[model samples]
Target: MTPYAIATQYAVTLLPETDINSHFYEITVDYRGHGLWAITRHRECMNHDGDWDWEPIPSERTDEWIAAHRFDLDTALRLAKEAAPHVTVNGITAVEALARSARREAQS
Candidate 1:
C-alpha cells in the first residue's frame, strides 16, 4: 500500500462567533478509509500557552465536517505539526505502526 493510504490525514476548521470558546476551532485526523480516527477542538488563542488543553470533539461531527470540507493534506499536516509539536511524534509512530501492520497482514 502507498504510504498515504495508512498515513493520517488532518484538517482544521475555524468557526464563526457565538459558539463556546472551547469549540472555536476543530481539528480532525483520518486513518485509512476507516473514517475519522481522532478529533479535537481548541479555544481561540493568540498565543500558545504550552499546555495540553484541547477538548475532544465528537466523532460524528468530525466525520460530517471532513466529508463536507476538502483539505490540503500536506499543508494541514505541516500546520498541525507546527501548532502541536507532539503531533509530529504521534504521526510518525502511527505511520510506522500502520506500515508494520500492513506488512504483517500481507505476510499472513
Candidate 2:
C-alpha cells in the first residue's frame, strides 16, 4: 500500500481462529473506507521471537483454515453490511473491496 493510503477508522471483527489470542482476523478497511488488504491470520500467541510476527495466509489454506475455525468470510461481510447500512462502498461488494483498492493503488 502507498504511504498516502491510510487505514479507515473502523475494523471488521471476525470469529477467532482458535483460542490463541485476543485478536484474530484483525481486518481493517483501506483508506477508502473499504476492506481490502485485510489481515487474516491466526494470532494464537506470540512466536519464539517474542513478537506477533507472521506471514500472509496462502490462498490454498483459506478453506482449510475456515473449516477448522468454522468461520466464513462471506457471512462476516454480510453481517457488517446488515449492521451498518450507512456505510457506503460505491456499490462494490465487500469481497471485491480490497481488490479494487489494490488496483487503484497499483495505478498510482
Candidate 3:
C-alpha cells in the first residue's frame, strides 16, 4: 500500500494593519483526499504559556462539511500571494513554488 499523507504548505507574514501588540497572518494550503484541497487562514496570538499561538480564522465556506467542492492550485496560490506578497520562494510569486519559503525563514 502507498503511504497516506496530508501535505501542507504555508505562507505567513505580519499583517500590515497589525497593532504593535498583535502581529499575525497566515495562509496555508493543505492537500486533502481525492481532488479536494483546503485553503485556511490563521492568526497569531498568545497561548496559555504566554507564547506565540496560531488559530484558524474561520469562515462559513471553510467551517462546515460539504459533500463535494471544487478548488484549484492557482486559486490557492493567489490567496497566499494576496495574504503576503513577500511570502515567496526565491522571489517567485507563485505559492505552489513557495512551500520551501518556511524552511528558508527557519534557516535564516
What's the CA RMSD of model 3 in angstroms? 12.8
Tens-place lDDT per residue, model 3, 1-108, is: 898865455444433333221123345555545655445444332222323334444343343232222235565555544556443334554343334445554687
Per-residue error at 100 for model 3, in Å?
A: 24
Model 2 residue 9 lDDT score? 32
| Candidate number with greatest lDDT | 3
Lowest-sum lDDT 10-residue window in model 1? 41-50
* lDDT of model 2 at position 89: 43
TM-score ranking, best first: 3, 1, 2
Backbone clashes under 3 angstroms, per model: 0, 1, 0
* RMSD vs true structure, all candidates: 15.9, 17.8, 12.8
Residue 18 lDDT in model 2?
Answer: 33
Give the per-residue lDDT of model 2 (tens digit) for 1-108.
656754343355432233132122244322212232222224321222222334324454454443333223354344343433222345644334444545666798
Model 1 spans > 4 angstroms off:
1-52, 56-77, 81-92
Instruction: Please list the C-alpha lDDT of all candidates, in the order they appear.
Output: 0.38, 0.35, 0.42
Q: How does model 2 fare in lDDT?
A: 0.35
The whole-model C-alpha lDDT of candidate 3 against the native structure comes to 0.42
lDDT pick, better of 1 and 2: 1
